[model samples]
Target: MTISVNGEKKVFEKAQMSVRELLDALEYKVGFAVALNTTFVLNTTYETTMIKDGDALDILAPVQGG
Candidate 1:
């Protein structure tokens, strides 16, 4: 399956994957927020949220500035 992550196209070997699984596959740890297909995804539902082909995922990390 092909999905756009943070505006970049990424191809996966599976037909579908959960948000949590995708994060793990990409080696992403805690401290980030995700929006799927322009909708915000709850952190509690990451393990249950299924991601399919052509889906768009935006992962954002908090930034601190002086």
Candidate 2:
């Protein structure tokens, strides 16, 4: 299936993947906030949440002050 990650298109081998799997595969930082299909995905619920095709995801990380 095809999906968009941070505005870039990506094709996955399977149609469904949990948020944990997605983060692991994409190598995004664990502290980042993830928005899937315009909805925020809680860090605690990533392991149980499922991602589908054509989903638009935005992974944002916090930056500390200097």
- What digit string (tens of lDDT, one per residue) describes model 2 on residues 7-55? 9999999888998998999887657899998989888899998989988
User: Which residue pairs show backbone clashes in model 2?
Assistant: none
Q: Over 4 Å off in model 1, which ranges?
A: none
lDDT tens string, model 1, 1-66? 999999999999999999999999999999999999999999999999999999999999999999
Residue 16 displacement in candidate 1 (angstroms): 0.5
lDDT of 1 at 17: 100
lDDT of 2 at 60: 88
Q: lDDT per prediction?
A: 0.99, 0.89
Error of 2 at 27 (Å): 1.6
